[model samples]
Target: MKVLLASPRGFCAGVNMAIDSLEIALKAFGPPLYVYHEIVHNKYVVTHFREKGVEFVDHLEEVPHGATLLFSAHGVSPEVREAARERNLTAIDATCPLVTKVHLEAIKYARQGYTIFLIGHEGHDEVVGTMGEAPEAIVLVETPEDVAGLTVADETKLAYLTQTTLSVDDANRIISRLKERFPQIASPPKDDICYATQNRQEAVALLCSEANLVLVLGSQNSSNSQRLAELARERGVAAHLIDGAGDIEAQWLDGVETVLVTAGASAPEVVVEECLDFLRDHYGAEVEVRTTREEHVSFPLPKELRAVSVE
Candidate 1:
């Protein structure tokens, strides 16, 4: 067996920043730290943090008063921020800059009296966070079918923003439908999908062209990771989205020759290496890294934690 690894596979800049911020905060502020959500949507990462004394909560009410809290990379709604303030929690935002850009755009469009149509999964952390920016003015649409059934007062005064991690081709198809229905609808100055998401998908698509089977390493809840597997399926190749090597089934590899290995932005590189090692040990697989793009992006730690001293 031969393994073809996708370039730009694991740990995008935003994920790196978010995870690093937590590690730094833990060192600086000490344990009992609270996070608004899974910092990057990977169970492995979350489990590691949990073992290290990090607390992940879905609601602000679960957090204790006057404690230090960190927002996830997926971002949070204004309501969440207000709730944190009400609880007197010292909060630090670890939202990716790209996701923050979309929130700002939503706020801007809402201020301009545009009814915003946000394209994203209904319950995704990022979608929920973005919707919180202007909940009264934003309507969520998850598919082209959703676009067809959408009802707005004035189509001309409409604008669209998308979740950062979405299927590239699927998003394009929905956008096309929206354009046909509302020609005057406005879009973001650039597509809201971030560079990391695009590059990972592109790398997987490139892998699909040659590999018979593709393996995407990420948590089930990871949007970009799911999109990689879906993209391969859309291209008529077999693909599986797995959290780690433990999730891989030997039956799926039967008759499979060239396997494409990739990871989501939030997945740690160790997971990829472990999966590779598993494949090699079991199947005598030869490995090669495929390069589609080179990424050099980084984000700084939150201001409040920058000067905090570690014990």
Candidate 2:
């Protein structure tokens, strides 16, 4: 068996910074650390943190007053931050800078009296948080069809922003539709989809040409990971999004000579290694790496964790 591993596949700069922030917080704040959402939407990363005493809560009421709460990389709305403050919780922001960029854009457009159309999956943590930024000013559009049915008080004053982890092709399709319906639709100065997402998708698409099946290493809920699998299937290749090596079924390997492996932006590299190990041990797979491009972006730790010395 042959395995093609994708470079620049897992743990983008934002995920690394978020994970490192939590690690520093865990050391500085001691036990019982509380996180607003799954740190990065990866099952392995969240489960690992949970084992290390990080409490993942969906609601602020579940967190104790005066506790230290870390926001997930998905980024929280101003409302969530205010609730954390109301409870006297020491909140540390771990939201990805890219996601934060979209939030800022939403705030910008809303402040200017423009109706913002957010291109993202409905109910996604990032989308939910972003919409909360300007609830009354922003409208969620999941598909181009949603764009067709859009009702706006002012089409002349319209703008669009997208979730950071959205599929590039999907976002572009939606953006194109938005443009067709409303040529005056304004866009963010830069693309909203994070660089890591585009890179991983492009890398996987390249690998798909040589593989009989593609294995995406990420949790079921991971948006970018799902895109990796979706990208492959769109190209008529078999693909699966598995949380880790254990989730891989033997039937998936049947009649498969080559497997392309890639991880989502939030996925941990250790899980990718584990999946590789599984394929190597079971099928004696030979590995080859496909590099799309090198990424050097990094974000500074939250102010609260900057002074903490983590071993």
Candidate 3:
């Protein structure tokens, strides 16, 4: 068997920044640090943090009063911020700058009397966060068909913003449908899908062209990871989303001569290496590294933690 590895796979700039922020917080404040959600959508990453005394919570109410809180890279709604303030928690905004950009756009459109159509899955953390920015004015749409059924208060005054982690092709198709229905609608000045998401999806597409099976390393809840697997399937290639090497089944390798290995934006490269090691030890797979794009993007640490000491 042969293993083809996708380039630009694993942790993106935003995930790196978020994780570093948490680690810094843990060092500075010590145990019982509260995170609004998983620092990133990768199970392995979350588990590692949990073992290091980080506490992940879905609601702010779970956090004790006046404790330090860190928002996830997926970002949070204004309501979450208000809740943090009400609880008197020392909050740090670890939200990805790209996700923050979408929220600002939603707020801008809402303030101008436009009904915003948010294109993303219903319950994704990023979508939930963006929608929370202007829930009264934003409607969620998952598919092109959903766009057709949209009943807006004013068609002439409509705008759309998308979740940062979405399938580029799918978002475009849905955007096209919205354009057909409401030609006057406005959209973000540029595509909202993050650079890392776009790069990884494009890399998967490249892998699909030559491999029989594509394995995406990420948690199931990871939107970008799920999109990578779905993109391979859409291209008629078999794909699986696994948390790590343990999730790989021997049956999956049967009669499979070539496999494409890739990871989501939040996944660590170490996990991908473990998967690669498994394929090499069991299947005697010959590995080849493939590069579709070169990424040099980097985001600075959160402001509040800049001066925080880290051991």
- Work out the TM-score per prediction: 0.97, 0.98, 0.98
Candidate 3 total steric clashes: 0
User: In candidate 2, what are the lDDT values of residues 1-311, reduced to their tens digit?
Assistant: 99989887999989999999999999888879999978988888888988999999999999999999999999999999999999999999988889999999999999999999999998899999999999999999998778878989888999999988888888889999999999999999998899999999999877799999999998889999999999999999999999889999999999899999999998888999999999999999999998888988888998788878433
The alpha-carbon lDDT assigned to residue 13 of candidate 1 equals: 89
Residue pairs of candidate 1 with colliding backbone atoms: none
Please identify which of the two predictions, 2 or 3, would achieve the higher lDDT against the true structure.
Answer: 3
Q: After superposition, how far is residue 265 of candidate 3 from its true place, in Å?
A: 0.7
Q: Which regions of candidate 2 are displaced past 4 Å? A: none
Model 3 residue runs over 4 Å out of place are 309-311
RMSD of each: 1.3, 1.1, 1.1
Candidate 1's TM-score reads 0.97
lDDT of 3 at 113: 95
Question: Model 1, which residues run further than 4 Å from truth?
Answer: 309-311
